[model samples]
Target: MLSYTGGFVLLAALLHASWNAMLHGNRDRFLSMTWMSIAMAAVSSVAVIALPLPADAAWPCIVASGLVHIVYNVSLVRSYKRGDLAQAYPIARGSSPMLVTLGAALFAHEAIGPLHAFGIVLISGGIMALALQGRHVSRSSALAAFVTGVTIAVYTVIDGIGVRASNGQALAYTAWMFMFYWLMPLLFVTMRGLPALWAPLRDAPMAIGSSVVGGLVSIAAYGIVIWAMQSGAMGAVSALRETSVVFAALIGRVFLRETVSAKRWLACVVVAAGAVCLGM
Candidate 1:
């Protein structure tokens, strides 16, 4: 299981970047996210029907993490409203890994190897530098991004425990978690009215298709990481998942045609070096 953690997190990283790119591409970030969540809810509703119910012990974690995710998603949309994808994405992701890692050590009795610790530092440093570079982000955007990071850390830790308490029903817990998490976004979208809600998709079937694909990609990514948590160290898994920041930069450059400076490339190199250290 440890040996596969690298591959699992790598896959999660790529998928995470892809879905975030899709969210960034939309004209209305929050609505786009809501639609994505709706798609996730649809799929998850079906999944929960097939899976066994999780133990009573797992419900608290599921409920708590769902609330945290709603906050995270709101912060994400707000951050991106005032910041570039490259800047906001890194800032949102940068601090989370370390927070999760330290929390795991202190509260969950998880141990990190010296090498893994070094790698986490490297990854965090690179992403933070990337986040703080190349833009005049508003103070509010920075705060939103910082809050997003905190939520990411919080949910990561919560889910780590939640999935563990699932009593052979971790996947069911995940399905339920998605269903619960969708409620906040659905409410947000509904508040915007029915016509406004359907307008984006009414014109673009391709957008609908892409959003569905993005939602699925995101679910698969988290599914892999969540499953990995059962047998791998939570801190390490969280740090490794932040490799998505590097992929985010690449996504910004290619898909969005955003400029990639020498600094960004250097950050990517640092991220690669950190991944190597993580693997060792």
Candidate 2:
């Protein structure tokens, strides 16, 4: 049976796919992403104020995660530029869990049982097949998606350790991390003159709407994942999170009207089985 934390992480996986689907439709994806980050920072500010202060030990991890998140965002943007949303998102999400599992095992010294290891393999393989299902993406885009996965792995392991060290205040630590998540994007946009940033918004009201909604969803999604990570195995939690790829495919079919093939549907089943294995 799936543990309660596993169940919650599955919930988070769905939310994660929802927000990313919203994001994929943005004409000015970078700007929409900026808006999402700004929205997250704004809400996180409230969380920081309302939640109890994180212990001093958590600060180091918060700082490290903030820096790493910049690369993650940039890499994601690059991935989008190179490939279609359906392809890019799955590649990034699918590749991440395996890397996270390995990182946890080697550096964090987290022990994984054989079943969890097989689950990670299934997830990675299924997602890889799903990512390659659609129109061919540029190699550069594929590389960027792979890099996004790596960055995700790094930050995830960092946050997993940091959250555990927080004792019971992991939420506050996450709040602070979200508060700074927008800094890198903000700086890049500002460099071209802040006016250039908002100029794109004038033409794309729908993108703006998605940004606001996606922003809120992403913040809550990560918050839930971080909370689960504190109690669950980071490797298991990370693998379960990638099941978002299955949801992404369905979202693409339903809302985006993209044609998803039957083979891809089978891949989704493989991904689901991996997630179930992790939960067990």
Candidate 3:
């Protein structure tokens, strides 16, 4: 069941990349994400009402994770705006597993086996190899990309722990988390970017559709992953779920017409192999 669920999780990853590709292709990236966040909140809020809430202690972690994720979203859009998608995306994503693995060791007290360490190194290296184009990426974009990666790692590990603390109701935990998750972004938009918000909201139907699809895809992806974890191993589930990076790279190359150099394809293969090893 774990292995089968892991495969389903990979489909979830593909869905994740699909929506992200949609957002990346859009003209109004930030606005699309904001709309998506708003829609996601509504959808997840309904789920939260239908499902059981997470344990009380998990609430704090969910709130904190949402705050970290808000920062991540801001940094991610800024990074994408300032840099190429192929370059910024991988860097931001590649840096996360290392942080999550470390957190797993220190906090979860999970034994870091040699295979897991090697898998992390391979995944990180592969992502970096794919991202480093050495042209047009400014220092600021690079910094933002790295910071986004760190935030991803923080939120992933926190969510993993929070989900575990739910006493087996991972779906409910996720629904509750998403309900609060929408609050931070809403408040940020209302408080900080009030003027910019109305204009984007008024002008674009494509933006709205992109937001809705992105939000739905994102919620579904995480829902599959949380369910997978209920019957699967965390480290394996996490690694498999992140295979979205590979799909993202391929999508960027084929759909977005970004370069898919031999080196990057090779790196993607290596990372996929590492994920397989983590599962094994």
Best by lDDT: 2
Residue 41, candidate 2: Cα error in Å is 0.4
TM-score of 1: 0.91
Encode model 2's per-residue lDDT on 107-134: one tens digit a residue: 7798878888788888878867766666
Off by over 4 Å in 3: 184-188, 191-195
Clashes of each: 0, 0, 0
TM-scores of the models, in the order given: 0.91, 0.92, 0.89
> What local lDDT score does residue 159 receive in model 3, on the 0 to 100 scale?
80
How would the candidate models be sorted by TM-score, starting from the highest?
2, 1, 3
Cα lDDT computed for each candidate against the true fold: 0.79, 0.81, 0.73
> What 10-residue stretch in candidate 1 is worst by lDDT?
271-280
The per-residue C-alpha lDDT of model 2 at residue 92 equals 85
Clashes by residue pair, model 3: none
Residue 275's lDDT within candidate 2 is 65
Local error of candidate 3 at residue 28 (angstroms): 2.2
